[model samples]
Target: MKVVETVSGIRETLANMRTAPGKRLKVGFVPTMGYLHEGHQSLLSKAKAECDIVVLSIFVNPLQFGPNEDFDKYPRDSERDLRLAEQSGCDVVFMPSVQEMYPNPIRTSVSVKGVTERLCGASRPGHFDGVAAVVLKLFHIVQPDKAYFGLKDAQQVAVISQMVSDLNVPVDIVPCPILREADGLAMSSRNVYLSAEERREALVLSKALGMAERLAQEEGLTFEALRNKIEGEIRSTPLADIDYIEVLSYPELEPVDPSMETVSRTSDMIVALAVKFGKTRLIDNVILHRK
Candidate 1:
């Protein structure tokens, strides 16, 4: 696999590859912030299975992080990431630097409303704005027919999907299933931030979500009651600090009213969690589908 750094080089390379005689390449793209893991590999593997060529971009987008968030300290291993990408059948690796991507000061950005108003968006102001901007940039750069994302960031997937539909960007957004650790903690690049004890405590996020899903399935609990129960479970873990626990509709992420009582059997709901274990904050969600 070839590693391209400059914007012009990647564009030129892709253009050339497209022009190859008798070769029709259906390109699939996976945009990541590096620190490759099984979650990322799942995306690559899916892309490889469905596309003629797969491209993975690893640039720690400064736009996606808040001023107080861990941008500088975010874990990165380009050499290791490249190895993982190549091993995962990535045809090309676009490892651009911040300077290369921005070139000059960025005066513009992209965003989707309603969907960005709650959960992570409300918790971290302007977070989705950065995500939308960088994602659009990568979408433009890669120009893939299909781009993959993990369903772990359900809100993010929703926002990006809405943006593509609204803006008429000609790329398919494919959300792969969330990959989890054996202990049920949602896999994240930030997972590396947790200490051993904090890591063990982190399981509460998933455990609570699992319980919420089961309750929605069998117990027919009210939205408010389910959310409160999930929050109570997380709080039970002394090491877990709750950031937000929300029960919202799928894709739209519209708030499920507290007074709505029980959910219909056919309703789709996402139970999302954001909790801090020590200095590391992790997010996890479980989508309850009609049985």
Candidate 2:
């Protein structure tokens, strides 16, 4: 129920949390840009169940946005988000200003190689560097014992996991399941920008991924065949413009070669897709793990 705007204030509060006499509380952090939804609520719900104190930080990090990206236009509603956070069982909400986080004009950034070379990383360029930098800053600021992220942004999750592992960040990175609409569209803040018609078309992203998953379960379907089928499904929708339809190894995110025997029915894989419906770009994914 407490809201802290300044980094120092939150740090001081968190310090008290650790040193407070009697019970030592376990902190869980969920870092996000403001506009709250069912997906974000799902993360907080999980965090609340697992940790004693849940810290939700709502800062639309400029560091993670490209020059021409939607940082300025990104949807934000802190009042509503704050209410939702409290309802979702958040103990504190950290809402910091851009200037406060970057008082001196940022000159440093974090990056993880290999994992950042494909999918959203390749398309956005320097996007993961911004994400890594901002996340590290938040992780330091919140000082949570565990940080929660959703599986919808699988690439982002992979990048963060890699950064945490490589740098030995002392926190558990917990990824929750992707929460979808009743119609199967993955929830996103940008979903607000979609026109009514575009919203309908956007379901193709999930539908295609569903097809990919089904194909993966069938015998004799190569990686290429599954990818091609998924791509075809997206292209069939008049409003959907393909950004990227990729089938890659999970966590590692390396593209799966069709000729490789490792890509058979029993292989673990991720089907990721990004599509543009008019000016709104949306991303979704499905993880395949068959025994």
Worst 10 residues of 2 by lDDT: 258-267
RMSD of each: 1.1, 1.2
The TM-scores, one per candidate, come to 0.97, 0.97
lDDT of 2: 0.89
Lowest lDDT block of 10, candidate 1: 258-267
Candidate 2, TM-score vs. the true structure? 0.97
In candidate 1, stretches whose alpha carbon ends up further than 4 angstroms from where it belongs are none
Candidate 2, residue 135: the lDDT equals 95
Q: List the residue pairs that clash in candidate 2.
A: none
Per-residue lDDT over 209-241 for candidate 2, one digit per residue giving the tens place of the 0 to 100 score: 887777777777778878888888888999998
Tens-place lDDT digits, model 1, residues 49-167: 99988999999999889999999999999989998998999999998999999999999978789999999999999999999999999999989999999999999999999999999
Error of 1 at 10 (Å): 0.4
lDDT of 1 at 149: 98
